[model samples]
Target chain A: MPRKAADEIVIALAGQPNCGKSTLFNAVAGFKVDVGNFAGTSVAFAETRVTFHGRKIRLIDLPGTYSISSHDLAEKVARDFLLSGEVDALINVVDASMLSRSLEFSVQLTEMRVPMVMCLNMMDEAQRKGMEIDTSRLEELLGIPVRTAVAVVGTGIDEVFRQAIRVAGGVVPAVEPRYDNDIEQALSRLLAVYPQALKDALPLSERFVALRLLEKDEDFERKVGASSPDFLARASEERHRLAEREGRAETLALGSHRHGLVLDLYEKVVRHRRGNVLGTREKVDRFIIHPIGGAITVVGSLLITFFLAFFLGNAIAGLVDVPFGALRASIQAMPKGMGPAVLIGLFEGVVAGAGIVLPYLVPLLVLLAIFEDTGLLPRIAFMVDGILHRVGLHGSSVVPLILGFGCNVPSIMATRTLENPRDRFVTMMVAPFVTCSARSVVIIALAGKYLGVLATVALYLFGGLMSMAVSYSLTRSKKRKSLGVIMEVPPLRQPYPRIVVRKVWLRLREFVLVAWPVLIVSSLALSLLSYAGADATINGLLSPLTTSVLQLPAAVGIPLFLGLFRKELTLIMLGAALGTDAIGNVLSNGQILVLVVFTMLYVPCVATLAAQWREGGFKTAAASALLNLGVSIAVAGAVARFVGAA
Target chain B: MEGETAAIHALHSDGATRKRIQSLGLFEGRRICVVARAPFSGPLLVEDVATGARVMIARDLAENIEMESRAPEGR
Candidate 1:
């Protein structure tokens, strides 16, 4: 939130997707940068400060974009930031092995006339594949200082920044890219007649303006429109006539022309051993994404991750449970009638806040972040793209739903990885149907106790089917067909430990700050209601829904109600009301199945509702609650009737 | 063309899809390869041979990305 000082030099790190831009930012700026991979990870630039060459520079980690085309959100961010004129210089990070492709972007930066430097990152990987890039030759051709780096291991970073500081100080002049003679002649003509933009378009000029118009970039046209309505028209006419003269579209001719120049430059400097370049990545991807192998790996990896979070989260949660249990007992025993309701409320709040949720939520979020950081998740998304398309969601929805098995909160948060709003909403709503561990405690307890094993298995399978149906129905629209799923598959790397820990700590802090307050306060209120002897009144209120509709006895209402605050509480209170853990003492087998089904499908916990309210707004939260209520009640009532008849 | 290296002949995609692909360094004259396709009618994995940037195109969109094979029948 702190503003950069006026004198600090602002340097933007721009690159194609997964080009180690962020990896380099962390190496230089010291690991505080907010990290995300693939496209549009950071919608706007994430700024960090580092002292380089005796000057503290404000480094902006721009989103990964292939070019400054205004098609996607991330590209728009990169494009607008480059033209913003706030940047003192640019450091274009090019993946070293992918030199010719990355150079196409480098050529644009040079043409924009921004003082620039090129960071040829991933030099080690380039070498492993037998690519020998002549950095000196590249520097000679591009007119910008070039530095080589293996950013993940932090090599050549200091030299990159040292040269960046020197460039920002105006030691380097902006370089212009060469184009085809026909387009070149048209560019010169356009530049001659160009009406300058009215605003202070520093770092952009008549030449860059003319080229942008030639590229037929619509966003640039709109910006330039206020001053020159006829300017683009004249430029378009030139481009059109030129295209007619050449036997191709003007843009393609110019693109290939610019690309030809880049290819020629790199051709002089780089040597490659072809056919041998498809190395470990291709090998690993072959087995892992192979339909049979992919299915096993995906299923196997997810099962292991869940078992780890579940067992580990539960074990760590024990440390919280004991102290909070003692604290609650002491608070409950406080002097008679001294606002016992308040005291009970206070005690319940502490237990739910510390003892119940955090145990599972912390480990789950950390593990999910690890999957995200390692770039393993998008591959899972890629494999599942076909199945998920049937549900009106993208492949990325798989990551959040898998995380939803641990807890719905972070899984909902994980949907931010999904770019579309409707996708996020539908994913968020269906995510709760994954049978989170909390609800698992209640379902396993009740269903396992009364109906034995098979019905419980059937119950879980039911939840999965409902999740797909719900998400599909909520998000399907023919008009808003997804723009196709184009995910960047980052090379598998060791997860950065610092970033992983920091993400866990940051998101856990949200649970502590936002969700726990709602949780604790509601826990207190629920406990206070029982203490105030309002149990009978509550049972009466729920009678229509419970006995008449769900066909469960009135005694089940309080546990079902308290389950909203903490799902495990349903079992605890049920044991207390029934006078034993043997739930079959009061309920028939059929009645038990209906009750557990309703519990599993009913509204998400109060804390989860609070999260929905925060992330999706009041309308979304209300809609989800209504959806859960209607589905569970109707299903439970029909099943209860079928069971009674049987 | 299934396993061969090819040059993008011409893109038949609409505006949004075309511009989006262009941002991923896909355009006319770029060389590409069809790496593999999932069995039972899955997405086709295509890579820009020059960049090593891979994209998985659904069967429907593959029709729009017309290509002329560049590599010979056998390696």
Candidate 2:
């Protein structure tokens, strides 16, 4: 489609993975994107409007990609947008610390010939590595405006945007990258054979198309082949000629050729003086990544996060309980009828929301954010790959699985990084069973409240085991295993308190805005239903399973039904349904355990199901619901039997 | 293979995996070091000696990538 805002200048921030593009984007766009140390954190582009230098600027943070070669969906998203020609100006953010690899990507960006400026981000990182870069030299070398920025500290951020604004307003002087003489001849030869029809059809510049074609980019090759198979044939011949000269695949030959130029440029511009770097961090990793120690650290850190959130949430819950109880007593004193019931419904909704938000959701999100920002998630992924592989998952699958604990929506979304459709399907299928924070609230409030901490932990372990079993069963029939994980382990960084707070707020706000309102409205509706004596019919209808199989109180039917709306509602609505927020008053310990287990593994919340539908269509979503229903029934039934036997 | 430097000789993996690895700057003839390995046949942390960038390659993929032993380039 055409550009929506004709008058506004559209600038896009693009860079390789974890090179601080989101950091720089947020610096100017004011926290429109999530910034994390993990690669592929921003799986989708984030866009915002800003009035910069007295001009209406639409700035977009594209997903960070290693190259425009488009190996996976993230890279394809970035490449397609950049080549869409909608970006009026581009900010190529490069990590000053990883200058050589970053510059290799910068070299590819220059090939696009868009109006661009280079932002040398993380200059402090480079300084720590003892690499002093000559910005002027880089500017002269790349023939574009270059600026230095430490985005975390807000240093040189505005100057980077100022340069981008200037460059967008003016002409981008064409700066073509020159390769070695032979490869240059080969590229021109391939370009000469490029069809005029294809040239206009393809959005990329002719030289870039030629280079990517030479590199055997699948997307470009298909595009070119569709336009002119004869051109593809001729291009293959030219590739063979170059391969003959280089004695390797033409793709690698071109890649190595570009790397040679980038290394040359890097040497000319970067002066490396000795500095103490990586000593302490490496020593630390030696233990953190040790065969035995790494496993312990992973399990230990996760347990610590769990117990901390659990006890901390319980403590906060205790503090909030007295006020809510006092409010309830006053409401009870007012009257006993429909109006009082509705008032109590609304009040209890707020109380239940506060109960979950303060006690469970907030603490959990904060801890998850800390794990994410500290760059520890990938390490956990690395450690868990072997175990996950036994269940037919790649190591990088751990990222999404861990994120599933926060919410299933982003967890399903994060599966985009996995290139294989089967891998993504398997991950998504198990994601809902991963005990999201909302479900954790149900488990902790019900099981932890009465059944004790051991029961809560056991419930979590059972959920995890069920998810693994599901993944294994799904992948066992497939003949091919998932392609092995190849992920960049970003350098560990100190989690910035500011960023962590924003990240937690971003997640917590979802609970407050989306889930809390749902909680309130559902509580009110359930109260109205109970006040109208309609819940008896709904509860009677579901009694076959809830009453007979799971052996829970029939009043739990509405809560379990509405729990499909939001898992936390199972806990929140339980108070409204049972006529008391103190669930233990109604439920025996085994009954609560059965209820939490059924709630934990049953059909995911509506938002999660919607996300599943979006990611994998209706069939996958149906599979998830069916899978959860079947598993929850089977397992909870066994638990009910076992608890009764015990 | 921990803490040993080697030159990448051949990438015997299939198209997509090879492309993914190469996109991160791993290529034939470039020297890389095995920085760390996870237990029970997990991924290995490999670093490019030239760029100082680290990536975790699954043991399966690492197996397909033939690495010739090389003397460590003095740090």
- Every candidate's lDDT: 0.73, 0.84
Report the Cα lDDT for residue B34, model 1.
81
Q: Model 2, range A1-646, lDDT digits (tens) per residue?
A: 3365777998989888888888777777774567767777777778888998898998888888888876677777787887776788999999988888888888888887788999999898788777889999899889899999998878998888888888884557356778889779988787777788887777667888888877778888898888888888877777778788868876676877887888889899998876466677666666777878898989898798789878998999999988889888999788668998789889988988886556888888888888888778888888888888888876778889988988988899888888888888889998999999888888887788898898889888988898889888988999986778889988777778887888888777777888788888888888888888899999999999998889888888999999888888888888778877777888878888888889988999999899999999999999999999998999998889888788
**Interface-residue RMSD per candidate?**
2.4, 1.2
* lDDT of candidate model 1 versus the reference: 0.73
Model 1 clash pairs are A345-A524
Candidate 2, residue A41: lDDT: 76
The ten-residue window of minimal lDDT in model 2 chain A covers: A169-178
The candidate that achieves the highest lDDT relative to the unseen native structure: 2
Write model 1 residue lDDT over A1-646, tens digit each, in one string.
Answer: 3565877998999988778898788777764665554344554467788878789788888877777766566677677777766778889999887787788888887877777899999898788667899888788788899999988778899999888888884654435666768778998887787654533443366777777777777777787776777877888888688767767766654665776787788788898777776667667777776778778867877666555555665576567767766765676567856387667656655565565556666666677678777777766766777787777766557667866765787677667656668777888888878888667656655675467556766776788888888877787654576534655566655677766886677667766776567655664555566666677798889899888998888878877887787665665566444433357878888988888888888898887788888889999889988998888888888999999989
Give me the TM-scores for chain A across all models, comma-separated: 0.79, 0.96
lDDT of 2: 0.84
